[model samples]
Target: MLSICKIYFMLFLYLSINLFIMALYFILLNMEVFIEYNLLSFNSLSMVMIVFIDWMTLFFMSFVLFIAALVTKYSEDYMGLDKSLNRFILLVVLFVLSMMFLIMSPNLISILLGWDGLGLVSYILVIYYQNIKSYNAGMLTALSNRVGDAALLIAIALMMNFESWNFIFYLDFFKNDDMMKIIMFFVILAAMTKSAQIPFSSWLPAAMAAPTPVSSLVHSSTLVTAGVYLLIRFSSAFSPMFMDFLLFISLFTMFMAGLGANFEFDLKKIIALSTLSQLGLMISILSLGNSDLAFFHLLTHALFKALLFMCAGMIIHSLNNCQDIRFMGGLSLYMPITCTLFNICNLSLCGLPFLSGFYSKDLVVEIMSMGYLNLFVYLIFYLSVGLTVCYSFRVVYYTFTGDSNILVLSTLNENSKIMLSSMIGLVFLVVFMGSILSWVMFPFPYFICLSFVMKMMTCFFILMGIFLGYECAKFSLEYSIKAVLFYNFSMFSASMWNMPFLSTFGVNYYPLFLGKIYMKNFDQGWLEYYGGKNLYNSLKMSSSSFQLFSRNHIKIYLLFIILWLMFMVSFLII
Candidate 1:
């Protein structure tokens, strides 16, 4: 008999297969199906719920479900010993459902519903361990996402001028209008927060406090990609100014995450940073007027990244939840299968030839070379690509090829068949999904012409990155002393340019300090003096005087009369 987790795994897998078939059919026939239900109507305006189904939507949803299915299966063994396994399974299912809603909706109102759902469920999952670190991570994750939620709400209100909430229909029609630009601005803002671009990026790495399975799902296909997907759907509405702005921000983000990953020590956080770098790549390319390329990379990234996280989870699980790469070395010797998959994913992440990531990532770089971008953009883009390989090789060296730092008594092996099977399922996709998706998405090949130097630039940087990564990982007395000499720089880079501090403490400190001052001067001091307390004191004093007057009224009147008689008698005598 199948267990509850297995049941869900099968259910999602079946749905994923069906959705893929439907997506293929839709793509082949060039068809879209819109299902809408009118909820209310007033004065030529209508409120309706819409499900917009196209090849993109169906394909994204299918991939999401497929990843969720494997993740659910993987979680069975990964989280098997936990007491609240059922609750975890339920949360994962809810998260997938919310993602589906997000993918299917063209209306802002319904999108917010899914958006908020992702935020809420993710917060719960982040704090699943019930610790202070998890709590803090959850708070940061939730609040960061709330910014995007508010942006989406503002967008929904702004779209009211069109008298229709279906943004897909109006995106191209209103592309040049100022109001549409404002709406698109808000939409891009929301996407930025969701995808953790630039200033919003700290939350993605902080969210590693969640369980590994949750991390795999949240980082891979569901929460972060929602932003990219939305931007893809609304690609026609982006203005030149907005595109340029997005370009710089995303380019910086890509560079920052890659550089930070090289300095990071935590295994999961490094992977999380890599995810941020890829998201930056997606948004940057999208800003360059290639939403399809961004979407293609998104799909390819989802496959390998999910599998990557699964392999990381297995390693973390076997090591009793120790996620520091410094303590994880010679893993390939013990857990051959897990390390092999991990290295494969890392190589794919580096865009090695014939791998899944190469199909999309290499194409993106080549096409970027053909664009009219400036020298600064080209330099940073290539440098970031190099940084990606540097970190990938760094992680590989630290966790797999270096001397064994783990305890000798620690038994490490790929013993969990359930977990292994789930990862194995994704491994195939990570190897083939890119090529398959590239062919399906692009019926016609992209024309490319580049000089020899320009064409060889990517390979040159990759090779340089490999050499640097090896040198960086090598341990020697001189290197150790040099690392200490550069301690401050290392700290800054490792902390993601102090992004976590900037996002949490740097943002909150001034506001909280101002609130303290306000409480002292206004709420507790001046307001108390001039408003409630003062009023109460004045009322009390008047009440006491009236009581005294009332209590001594007869005596007071007698004294007054006597004084008046005395004055009259004195006047008569005079």
Candidate 2:
């Protein structure tokens, strides 16, 4: 029954892809659809649900469902023997549904439903393993997302200043209003959190505690991209100051992630950080006033990044859960298919020539070059590209080349047909998705005219990155002086600049200390004395006085009654 259900879901997903493609063509012909309904209203504020679907929605949704289907089918074998297989499948399905809801809705209220749904479902999936690491990772993921959720809620509250809750209707309405600008600022904050930019970045790596399929689905296509997509949808509302701020934060995030990936050893984490770097790239590009380019990169990165994680999953499964790249080498000799796919995905990530990543990435770089950027920003962008290639090659060299690092008797190979078939589905897409998507999305190429040095910077960086990656991965540890001198910096980069520590303990220290003070001073001190202790003491004294008065005799009671009667008579006379 489980097998039948999985197959049915896959078949249905594929059918939907075909239908969506046909719909996309129709949408391209400018036959768009807008659906809106009023569910409820409270005086001026109305609960209006709006869905605006053009070619973009159909196209991105098809890709998302396609990936989800493949991941679901892959999980059939990857998680086949697990006792909670049904639960896992259900969670993935719910995740896909939530993403679909997010894609279709343009209403802030409706988007919140999908946004919160993704956060809640993702947290559940992250901690599905029930281990301490997963638990901590889940907490981090949930709390980080709550920041975005709060931001979104505040933005929605601010949107009430306008008559409509549908932000699609009022894209230009908030431009001149200071209050509206503040709301849009919160909206950008929400996007930054969802996309794992800057401070929110610690959650993306921590979320690797999830199964690989979830990582592929969440980190690659749906979860992290949620922020970029949101920003893209609302790009017109962003001010120049806001864009500049985003550009700064995003560049730092890109540089940081790229640098961190180079220092990383864990196979999954290296890729997770790569995803973060690409996210930074996407958001930064979007901030540069071209949502189309950012969207292009978003789709292409989804293809290769998902494949990369799936390949990592296969390798980890083969090695009995070994994720450290140092213990993996010469895998191309035994696991030829897995290694080949890994190389392809890694190269695509590096934006090599004609692969999906190259088309969007190269264009982004050239366009960025033409922009009015400062020296520092330009260096960070180009250097991040170089670092991307550096880490990609480093991963390839460590895991696929050199001597065998696996057990001598181990029979590791790409024998899992289920996993391979799922990957094979995306492999074709990752290779040709760029050209096809380019032709579909753009009628002509972006006219980028630059100097010889600027035009060739990408190639130069690629070559340099290859050299740097090889030397660094090959001899960084072996050379005594280099290792000793750079040990602290290496550790800092490896630890993601202590982001995990900062997110967990650094952010918690003050809050926890304040909580302790509240417990001592308020709960146990003033409140205890004034409310609990003082109330008890006053009650005891009153009871003792009443007992003494009662013991004195009937005269006391008679005197009290006379005084009460006199007071009542005087009040009546007045």
Candidate 3:
């Protein structure tokens, strides 16, 4: 206990130091223009918002402190009893500090460096569990993130050649039409990968292979949101093509993930899919060129998503590390506080009115009413919201409200105060997030209230989802690869990941998966047959022939045809 306290104290103390430095940097930026300050740095010179919104950096960093506190306290219970507990705490501290630096950076070059540092540390934490499975997931996650890094670096190279790299520089000067379009392409591709849109969505769901605390920070708070945050930050120079690209990709990711979460059995995997769905919504909202819509959702999503993940973690922890929601039930009987926090998170994620998610969710829907947003776009976003409710409620009902399946009644689950306290505080924020967002004035208004009729009508979807999700739970507790892969829930679908067993389980399904198997074999056969003997023998026979042209009647004919065409052109010219 003393060791845990010491670790928490050190982390909190370090965060407090960072917070203090940010405040001082902010103050210095606001000071009347001095010769000394102007010579010190371009970032300090260019920042105009420092006088007023500089504290926003401090606001974002407060969450860092909160997460660090949770990591330190939670590690004490999960690891402090272990021999290497202190090392774990040190690593967590370093990871959060890197995130703070990354997010608060003012310049593009600084931002890229900070971004790489952030990815490296989070990659380390994901594999810190040290299992082979964790290592594999970590490597795949790192590789996917590196795709974004490459795109970002390429954009930087282009900017340097054209001599336009900083946000302030772009705002003040340099707008070449062709160069701007090229830069936008690289920027959007990088953002899409980091945001986990569609094909790149494979990685985030696999990231559930990480520890629970790591998921809270990676999915709920920072890494996944970085791309959308960048989109919101650098949206000024976006052309129409860029916005259209962002809109379509964001909607596509939403539907793909929303459908997949419905079939997942693992508790963490469900939240992971839900995270993808939410990120999709976030990017879609930002793509509309409304900074308020993007920023409002950004703040609200953090509270509710974090609350949901922490609650899911508590439920899994209660079962002696069982993760599949199939075996979990009757948790309301065992842990009332756990159920209450879980319900609050679900309400917010599902966009229950007066909840934080409702404010941002409604704002995005309302913005869609403008001629700019088509019905097809609105339909996808709204349907994903309904599906979001379906899966989120599926988690709560399957894990808590239903009959007991593996109910071991030990001393009741009061979720290790370390975890519960952070969750409880977050739950409070989730309940009031809309209230806070309604007051946000960073840019345009995203605080539009929905009419009573629409609010009343939207409730029907949530109610229907809950009823259907409950009904679906009773018949089948089994998991299948087809269900998992189709919905992109690769996290908990290990059963058939390698061995498809597509035919063995009384199924004639998915000719595509079988085609891939044959394709692999087919490619190898061509390589061995042609390159090894057939093609090699053909080459040798051709070489051994005394007269190369005499043996090939077809080549001699082609030479005459080419010479005739050349002769025709020469005659015409003469």
Among all candidates shown, the one with the greatest lDDT: 1
Instruction: Write one digit per residue (lDDT tens) for candidate 1, span 220-321.
Output: 899999999998988898999999999999999999999898888889999999999999999999999999999999999999999889999999988878
What TM value does model 3 have? 0.75
lDDT of each: 0.91, 0.88, 0.70
Return the TM-score for each candidate structure. 0.90, 0.90, 0.75
Kindly list the per-residue Cα lDDT of model 3 for residues 1-574, writing each as its tens digit: 4675465756675775576466456545643221111224475454221111254455456655665576566556655455776666677767766667656655566668767876787788778778998887787678778888999888888877655455544632444467767877887888887878866777787788777877877776678877887777678778777788888988887877777777677788778878888888888877787765776687778777777777777777778778877777788988889889888878888888898888887667666654356678766766777787777776777877768777556444774877777677667778875775466433345344556766554576777777766655543354443465633534433222322133122232445578777666665567657666688888889877746767887988999999999999999999
Candidate 2, residues 92-134, lDDT tens digits: the string is 8888888889988888888899999999999999999999999
Rank the models by lDDT, top first: 1, 2, 3
Model 3: residues with Cα > 4 Å off, grouped in runs:
1-56, 171-176, 407-412, 442-457, 475-574
Model 1 spans > 4 angstroms off: 39-47, 475-478, 481-485, 517-574
Q: Considering summed lDDT, which 10 consecutive residues are worst modelled in model 3?
A: 31-40
